[model samples]
Target: MSVSVGIYSVPLVCEAVPQIGCGCLAKPVLARLEVHPDIAEAWLHHRGDVIAIKWLRELGVDQQVGLLRAALGGDGDSQVALVAAASSSPLLATFPNPSYWYQRETVDQLSQEEAHTIAARLVQRLSQARVPLPDGTALQCDLACALQEVLVVDEAMPIEARLARLLGVARDTFQQHLGSQALSQLDAWLTPAALLPEDAG
Candidate 1:
């Protein structure tokens, strides 16, 4: 007997991207969709409701059709599970762990270089797992370049803009509080006088 792997032959619903609340999943999914327009069209055509449920079931996950439907409809909880499934990440296992939460906070508090190191480790782990990237080589290159730009800080863009991009925040929002928050924090260390030695001549 031959075992089947891949998408099930489910009847199509409507051709439209289902709104999903998990932003993390959204990015990877969109990236994959861009590289594989056929898959994207198939997903949208199926409305994601049946697809999500069927996929989970195939994986032996005890998922509720209603919950999967809610996930496709942008429910936060269900979206998290779906994302975990897609990435082969232990997001669900760690979701309730205080230590995991603390680690995330600690990473956020680390210096840019340190955070970049952590991000690099994550990318390496993903690679080791042999998880299929959304678009393969091109998308991988784009992500690498983006990460490098954020870590190196583009001289052309203002500091606030760079920070905003790294933090995935809006430039306007980053600018609004830049003076009081980032600028003030950097004032002492980054000031020219701090870098220049006192006159000794």
Candidate 2:
């Protein structure tokens, strides 16, 4: 069963996504975040796109945002981790009008695309100069910050190499999973004449 619909209007500082919406908070993606102690219970619906979170204690907006950001990935500059929560749900959530990125895929579909998703998402972020969250929060999203949000490289690694590392798989698997366009985009980004030459290339 899904979270109770009536509770969605309780208004615990809803951070509705500004534009079309974001997959960052999508149930299948961000919903996989760790549910901290602050969250008493969570329910996921609409393919994990929309979530309802019951707080253990009352928290302010900043606290909620900070906690969610921390869970999404605050270990470094940008990397959101894939965590397994000991709860009925996998995401850090809260009550709202019941909406987020609606990807509309089943659990099997999500798993099928899970591999290389982090890397691909990082690559995808390259296109957006600004990253928006569920509550219309916009953060300056530069290449380095974007990489920091997802990929972790202890040693030196180029953009492609780092992305590959984030993929956590062989080249064949990455190609098979993400396909040619993502790779081609990476290649294009790496070119000397690529856009944002001053930034990560």
Candidate 3:
């Protein structure tokens, strides 16, 4: 039988890539991430995004933030090792709703290309708020910090207690600048929803 690896196992396929600084991961390829606890919780809090759901379900990692953290390579592991170590969280049941991305109303009304365009625009608008970072040698510090909030917890801080502390930092920092409005918007937009299965037709 042929093995069916989910999107999490695949590389990101982006036609137009962003400018990445030195410390950032090389190439915009899609890879599994070790998401921090809070980050996972944060992802769960959002309404929709099937891609994230499919990855989580297929990986069986439970915590999305931990996935992001692992992807960040906070540990000294080589790139290959890091990818191999990503947790595999499986889907236990059908998602509560069809993937927000492919909802019948939107998909039926819009062509695939148009749907993607709309989604991208919405994501851009929703994430407009700036996420601040502590000054340091790392380039794209603000973006990195924001990315870290969504990144999975690093292996360096594998234990729950340490992970919790890291989460505390994220919540406190975001809370201060974002306050209620920013947090509300993030909750509305970035939360992962269900994605249509690859074979769905």
Quick one: best TM-score, which candidate?
2
- Tens-place lDDT per residue, model 1, 84-111, is 3443233333332333221212222122
TM-score for all models, in order of appearance:
0.18, 0.29, 0.22
Show where candidate 1 strays beyond 4 Å.
Answer: 1-21, 26-51, 55-172, 178-201
| Sliding window of 10 residues with minimal summed lDDT for model 1 | 13-22
Error of 3 at 25 (Å): 12
Q: Which pairs clash inside model 1? A: none
Using TM-score as the yardstick, the better of models 1 and 3 is 3
lDDT of 3: 0.29
Please give the CA lDDT of all the candidate structures. 0.30, 0.35, 0.29
Please provide, for model 2 over 90-185, each residue's C-alpha lDDT reduced to its tens digit, 9 standing for 90 to 100.
333433324432222322223223323333444445445242222211222233233333332223334355444433332233344445655654
Better of 2 and 3 by lDDT: 2
RMSD of every prediction: 19.5, 14.3, 17.9
